[model samples]
Target: MSVTKGLVKVIKLEELKPQIGKEVQVLDQTIAIFRLTNDEVRAVSNRCPHKNGPLAEGIVSGEFVFCPLHDWKISLTTGEVQKPDNGCITTYETAVIDGYVYIGEPIQHEKHDPSR
Candidate 1:
């Protein structure tokens, strides 16, 4: 994956199908990428916050995806669980440039030093 100005290239724009979700791995994190009907792109955690369901396989309706496991509605834009559902998944910024889709920088956590 190529990183430029804090954005990591994930896939080519042509590789993503409109209204479909694609799962991608970045820095050991599973992220779900979506190409909306309007040709816009969105990125969020692949696992649902409720039951670890695979959001990539969910049905996309507008800006929301209904989790395949339990039918929990998740907002593709904000990663927020809909009413009656609790918690949220991580949302990543997405950009398409020169026919390539890019996501924001992955979260970085401080490493633990065993010798410390």
Candidate 2:
């Protein structure tokens, strides 16, 4: 069992098979889960980082998800920008128990680099 802030319970785990995807809504945010060839499940904010486009409806490939809005490639694992103007997407810790996928609450990352 895991505990996190905001009580963001585990939603799902690596269920989306390669070449397929799934969407899960948590609170006011929707998350898109993609299963890569390496059998890794990556979840990202369902909304596009650019125009708030629904990323859950986007096409996912490999370690990247192509935004349906402007075709922005967002990385799943590192939450880094795979393309220009594309930025990090919020990710929640995922775990699997008895073949059930659980999306843990968002990890409260401490504020760093105060020099903004």
Clashes of each: 0, 3
Error of 2 at 42 (Å): 1.4
lDDT of 2 by residue, 43-80 (tens): 67777778877777777777777788898887666555
Q: Against the true structure, what is every candidate's RMSD? A: 7.8, 4.6
The residue pairs in collision within model 2 are: 10-103, 11-103, 13-101
What range of 10 consecutive residues in model 1 has the weakest lDDT sum? 106-115
Clashes of 2: 3
Quote each prediction's TM-score: 0.88, 0.71
List residue ranges in candidate 1 displaced over 4 A.
106-116
lDDT per model, in order? 0.87, 0.65
Highest lDDT scorer:
1
Native-to-model Cα distance after best TM-score fit, residue 32 in candidate 1, in Å: 0.3
